[model samples]
Target: QKEVEQDPGPLSVPEGAIVSLNCTYSNSAFQYFMWYRQYSRKGPELLMYTYSSGNKEDGRFTAQVDKSSKYISLFIRDSQPSDSATYLCAMLLYGGATNKLIFGTGTLLAVQP
Candidate 1:
């Protein structure tokens, strides 16, 4: 089974809305979870990173992880037009010599003006 599962959505919302993006994992070994935002024709940029499990908030964004449930989520508050992008959820396990990020199929979001 795929380690991580995220809905590959073309989710649309109006400006100033609160958006919730989510990902679920099947692997219990994942220790590092991250959320990345990628603009069209641009590279993915890290938005939030969590070690182990906890809730992390920065500015208008918040990331939550529940290791016991193997679920992680990202919340965008006061969503703006600039926030329209593809959001990726990634996880890392430290066993391999060269650990690589396992990313979910990105979810596309559009915030209308």
Candidate 2:
């Protein structure tokens, strides 16, 4: 199985709707879980990072991690057109020398005007 897997969704929703993105991983050795948002061709910007199993909330974004199930999710509230972007979930190997991250394929989100 792939280390990380996510639906490459072109999920479209109305403005002000709630958006949910998710990812699943097969490795239990991953110690860091992160969510990144990318607009078009630009590089992804870190949205949230959780070191272990727990929930982290920032602004309208909430990140949830479940190490027992090896799953992670991101929730976006009060969604807007500006929030339309590709969301990527990433994980880093534990005790690795470098900070290399393994990424999911990404999900495309579009908030209608």
Candidate 3:
């Protein structure tokens, strides 16, 4: 099974709405977590990065991580049409010489006017 799993959402919402994206993992060794946003035909861009189990907010975006549950979430406030894109959740398992990065299948979000 994949270490991380996220809903491949074509999750649609109205502009100015609150949007929530989530992911779950089966691995307990993951120590680093991240969220990426990908526009159509473009590469994923790092949106949030954290190593601790807590909530981190940057402007309208908030990322929450819970190590005990192996769960992570990203929240977008005041969703915009410009925010329509694919969201990817990633985790890193760091070993002395074998750090591995795992990514989710990605959730697609669309904000409509």
What is the clash tally of candidate 2?
0
Residues 1-113, candidate 3: write the lDDT tens digits: 87899988889999999999999999888889999999999999999998999999999999999998889999999999999999999998899799887999999999999
Off by over 4 Å in 3: none
Across 1-113, the per-residue lDDT of candidate 1 in tens digits comes to 78999988989999999999999999887879999999999999999999867899999999999999999999999999999999999998767797879999999999999
Q: What is the C-alpha lDDT of each candidate?
A: 0.94, 0.93, 0.94
True lDDT of residue 44, candidate 2: 99
Q: Candidate 2: lDDT of 101?
A: 93
Residue-level lDDT tens digits of model 2 in 1-113: 88999987989999999988999999888889999999998999999999878899999999999999999999999999999999999998866577679999999999999
- Please state the error at residue 34 of candidate 1 in Å: 0.2
In model 3, what are the clashing residue pairs, if there are any?
none
Q: List the residue pairs that clash in candidate 2.
A: none
lDDT of 1 at 23: 97
Each candidate structure's TM-score, on Cα atoms with residue i matched to residue i, is 0.95, 0.95, 0.95
Whole-model lDDT, model 1: 0.94
Candidate number that wins on lDDT, 1 or 2 = 1
